[model samples]
Target: MDSPPFESFSRVLSETIGPLFVSAIIGGALQGVIGGQAIYYFKYNKADPLVMKCLVLFVWVLNILHYFLVVDAIFIYTVNGHGDPSSVSRLTWSDIAIVLVSDTGDLAVKSIFSYRVWRLSRQWYLSVAIMTGALVTFSFSLYLTITMIQSPSVMPNAVGTFGALITLAISDIIMSVILAMVFWKRRSVFPTVNRVLRMVILYSLETSLVTR
Candidate 1:
């Protein structure tokens, strides 16, 4: 008639704490990269466009907020309420906030790349396609966030969340491929530029692989 002593704790670790820890580690590393980019931009590209500078600042702020939300959730559920059955029975607001902020950060980064794809390719059709995919991914992510907030347990929203993640991954792959193609096409035109473009392509692929 009674559950095992470790049942609640195991469920909580599997459903929330484990995933949050992994996410926090990866997100923290990414935020570090973004910080490095910010430093480089301010140091070497002082004359860059105002819009570009603003976008960088926006992403920095968004990612920081995301990291904060994730840390807060970990503190609330694992650190403060550790081994508490009531806390493990349902998802919390902090958990939902982490999802929301993480999705928002992803959207912001994808938007920047979408614009870069457009600027480099000078092709309206490709840009439109990438932008459309980004929007759809964002929509699904928003739906997932809403469902998580409404649901008592994460299991109920698993399918929706997985679908959104798949969509987001596909969108990222498509954008990376298109950007690589753009670089490849121009490599022949500018021999001296090929090395830089190759590095860019490799970096794009690297990030995409990490995300997947």
Candidate 2:
């Protein structure tokens, strides 16, 4: 068979996708470090340390995934010297392994966070609803990632990473809204409402714009 178009795509993808993912990794790392520190020091009565730890895990996973996506994109770009599809299609098992590991980490964070919320609220109705919603969103995001990577052909850029990033932004918004309502109802006991409120809002807005 004729050599597939890989070189050209690689060059363009590398130049653009590589830098974008690198930037995302930097941002993710910074957020994880800063947010984790805040959670450690702030002593938010409303936040369970276990739940907060899950949030930190989520952030850490984001950074790890960011690095994985960037490196994979760069490698693929380099391999596809001039858009040759053959080598691109020949992705080693290691590549799939990396993606699988990161995907698992992503799911673990989601599960932990959902369990955390359920444990904290102790409200079956609300907690079940939140967990269900999170699961649905996670499924959609994963489907998007797989479709982008393996269908038709290999994507020149990191489509799965972008989908995950968007999913996170949307998830943050949903979670923030729920937490805000809880805080509003228990304002008397939850003195750190303002801080948690700010973090949720900032996380929603800030992550919404963060590209991967």
Candidate 3:
């Protein structure tokens, strides 16, 4: 039996660029969801504050740019590199940029949701803490990006990045727990709207976990 041609080449490409390729596909698909939500908000949310609308638009823009960067990274490794697997190991500007864009978008989203928490419960402390965690997460991502630029490896030491992710997850869990409790208490206060409050409690926790 003859050996298959390009077997080693295929393995190298799969190992080096597989995750990025898959991530870009998933991210592109989610962009459609995000776009739909943005469109609905713009069409139906005339009563929203100008600042709020602007913030939403800003986040949407960041998400779009991030998606582009992700695609550009794939192009850089696969297309631009002439299908050379070793090209994936060389970090590109798009790779570094995606990190900053992603982190900034996350911070913006957390700040918006934290404001919602404040509006519902008037708990300044919790909102502040969540924002603090988001900031910390962004800071760590920035550090990781810088480290990637300085290091030789495509995936650099990510301890700070991982710690930031853990902190962000904890913050989300804490926020959801507080939100559920607040909603639960309100269920007793407004008996007629109890069902709606209970649903909100479930939704908040479910969304938090799903995002995590």
Candidate 4:
């Protein structure tokens, strides 16, 4: 029999593995904060050995996911496309699914940090409000991701790119505000939260350079 059609091959790669990689990177890093926080909390409190051990395991898993995400994105966007826009056609549904999952993972990470703030200051109201806002932001991101992929003709479109950038910028601002609040509410935890935010901002700047 003749080889399967181009569409079938494209569908297989884009749908099956594309999301896996993108989510791996995006989700992995977001979840990594959760893992890292757990580790630090247990260590500082001198918690049960079981909990400590589990944190270590989680760290490894999240790190692995981050690594795979990088590999997958590069492969799909560059190697597979082979210097031709025609090489990559429609955005498989999987692409949209990956973006949604990754963005949700981001919200989760933010909530986890906000909860940490609550623990530090017992500011339940602030934590709940921030968490709700984060959810809304992620929901919008998910919708935009779906729309962009569903309409492949919009790829590299200025409107879509701006939408994504605006969402991310808002997210970064929210994260910064949370960090500032945490820093002010509990001076003791300032160093930790501030350090993380600094690294996050620096990485974002570096990534922007590469993208440009």
Residue-by-residue lDDT tens digits, candidate 1, 35-124: 898889778987867876787788789878888888788888787777676777677787777666766777777777777767778887
- Backbone clashes for every candidate come to 0, 14, 0, 0
User: How large is the C-alpha RMSD of every model relative to the true structure?
Assistant: 2.6, 6.4, 3.3, 8.5
For each candidate in the order shown, give its overall lDDT on alpha carbons.
0.78, 0.56, 0.81, 0.59
- Give all TM-scores, in the order shown: 0.85, 0.54, 0.83, 0.53
Error of 2 at 201 (Å): 5.5
Candidate number with greatest lDDT: 3
- Comparing candidate 1 with candidate 3, which one achieves the higher TM-score? 1
Q: Give every collision pair in model 3.
A: none
Task: Please give, for residues 134-156, the per-residue lDDT of candidate 2 as tens digits.
Answer: 56556655665465456535552
Model 2, stretches more than 4 Å misplaced?
Answer: 1-11, 14-16, 24-66, 79-106, 141-170, 189-212
Q: Model 4: how large is the Cα RMSD against the reference?
A: 8.5
lDDT of 3 by residue, 1-212 (tens): 22343465577678756887898899899999999999999999999788778889999999999989988987887788864645755778888888789889988888787787788789898788778888888888888888877874557656867876887787778778877876775666666699888888899899989999
Candidate 4 residue pairs that clash: none
| Reference-based TM-score, model 1 | 0.85
By the lDDT metric, which is better: model 1 or model 3? 3
Which candidate gets the maximum TM-score versus the true structure? 1
Clashing pairs in 1: none
